[model samples]
Target: MQVFVFDWTAYSENVDKFRENGKMIRLGKKHFNAKTAVDTYKNHAEAWQELERYGFDGVAINEHHGTPFGLGNSPNLMAAALSQLTERIKILVYANLLPIHEPLRLAEEIAMLDCMTGGRFICGVGRGAPREYKIFNVPMSESRGRFNEAFEVMRRAWTEDSFSFDGEFYKFDDVSIWPRPVQEPYPPIWVPLTGSKESIEWAAAHDAAITPGVFPGPMREDTIRYFAECQARYGRKVDPNKISIMVDCYVADSKEQAVDEYGSHLMYLFNTLLRYDQVWQEDVKKKGYYSSTAFEHLRNGAKGTLAEDDTVFNEWSMDTVRAAAENMPLGTADEIVERIIAECDDAGANNVLLVCNRGDIPHDMYLNQIRRIGEEVLPRLQAHNVTFVPHAQFEQAAS
Candidate 1:
């Protein structure tokens, strides 16, 4: 099993100062503090470097814009820095938003990172959050088409000597990129999904690995099952190594201790930061970002937000935190290991992405958590191997 830590790289200091009313205000230059932003990047980079020393296989970063939720507006830039800062740990952009980017340039940049890191880069692509669409002034309805065309352009740019693309969203002629990717054909492409059937099928068709995103256990299993079926339709077999699960984890002396320390940050994540520049799911659906059945299995007959139900957000409290912690991998190292392994086993996933930092926990505390995960959780997880894909097995049995 490969273990990766996902960092949000949020603006860490004085988080409460950014809030207006009860909600987080859209952060702009006024909210920006140069020292705070610098420290945030420096601390996260230091933490990422520590992952290499602590024996983590990779460190994952993501992109967001115009919010304090994640300062990683250009995850590619972060990955480039990581290539220089760390020696061995894979730097996963986990994803670059394809729809909003010029694909040829993205291709060249990723190739540069791949060459810089000597093929230790994983290219994760996605259509991005609804808020990002708004920031870029892109039509949410055209996200799928743009994402597909962008990926095709990048793919061609990476593999072909000279390629031309004339697509609805992008047009290029006689494009041959310098600094070709170190990996043959291209670097591994991974997609982080929110249980969208269309996204799953698209990933399967492209033979990209997928992380089922953060969701409850049942929904995650359904995603894997559907993905396996999709892979089979494309004449491919399910590979455990190609499936990854993202889980919010914390390691402490006991479950109670873990919850007591990490619960507030978790709550803040859900109640405040995540809601910054929030776009409601109903609006997203109306905009055609999601098909009618995209999230049918997970929806509870209520219009939810992109990641969770509106009720969950509205009803968030300490009780909600404790309840959520029950399912999360939070507890002693042994307990966390057990839960993570069980989740991976049940979902037929061999890779795990641990989200241990969020909601602007103190820098030292964040480092402590990473150190503990490295010393305690990492070894156990690294030792465990997932050998079979349950989804594929189930499909065979049904057939």
Candidate 2:
């Protein structure tokens, strides 16, 4: 049982408000505009270092947007910073958009980071955000195909010693990448999907992993069943223990305090992400997939409502968010830890990723959340044998 904290860095500064009137909680920094390198660097600095010092086996980051909100688009830079900041802790980058970049370049960057970290890197690649593809002017029709090609290209760039590739998307006369990654055969690749059975089957066939985030939702049972079925279809036995999930969490010294500080943020998360059928229209639904439904249900359920319409409702009140946050796991450290432990226990989770700041939380408060999780939650988790063995397993093999 590994407990990995995750933060979406969602800036609450995005949209205005809804009918319910609660601000639409965001998952990425409000980068509809642009952010100066100086400003972004100054903000995420402490959070990065604290994760390294904390009890986490590894520190993780994902490329969300470009420049501002999804600014970590170039994770090698982020990894480089992490290399200088911490002595240990695996640097897990959910990945450089495999489809959008030159595979050889990605390979080189990954290898360079691995060497810099003394081989402490776990790389995961995706087709880049579908929305981002539009922003980057990438052809969405070819996103999946391009991703598969780049995935192979990046690997060959690291492993083939010397090779050539002439694929539909990537064409290289010499598939040679300088400075190979330290991990043999390359780091593990986990495909993040929205409970797509095809995805599970594909991952199983390649011995890859999937983070179906739709886990632990209202359709939780169905989601698990689908994954199991996919594993079987792939003829590769998958230990439920190997599957991981992403759940929103928060903690405090007292339940009241937890509610006070985390209430609005939590509610905002549900409504924005799980907007109860609000985004189920074919267009909005097609954008992200059925998992969009998951958000709708989760948000609706949390607010004790039924999502019967598809009017793309955004109406919410701050009061609603405040109340939802109150009932959630926000509580004293002891109480919060208890809840986290219970989640891991029930799910038999091997790894846990925590999404820390969803709303535009004050930077200081975000750092405090990390520190609290590290000091109070981590020790008890390990003592109770709850956290899994490796949030990251990027240590260099014994020579």
- Per candidate, the number of residue pairs that clash is 0, 25
**Per-candidate RMSD, Å:** 2.0, 7.5
Worst 10 residues of 2 by lDDT: 390-399
User: What are the Cα lDDT values of the candidates?
Assistant: 0.85, 0.60
State every prediction's TM-score relative to the real structure: 0.95, 0.77
Residue-level lDDT of model 2, residues 1-399, one tens digit each, is: 566666444543433343234444432444343454455555776687777778676666787653223446667788898788878777778757776787888888888888889878878776554556656777655666777788778877878889898989888896567788788888767666553344445566666656654444434433344455545655544453465566666767776676678766654555554352222334533444223333332323312112223222344466765565554556677776676666655454556677677655667888888898888877776565533312111111110
Residue 194 displacement (Å), model 1: 1.1
Give the winner by lDDT.
Answer: 1
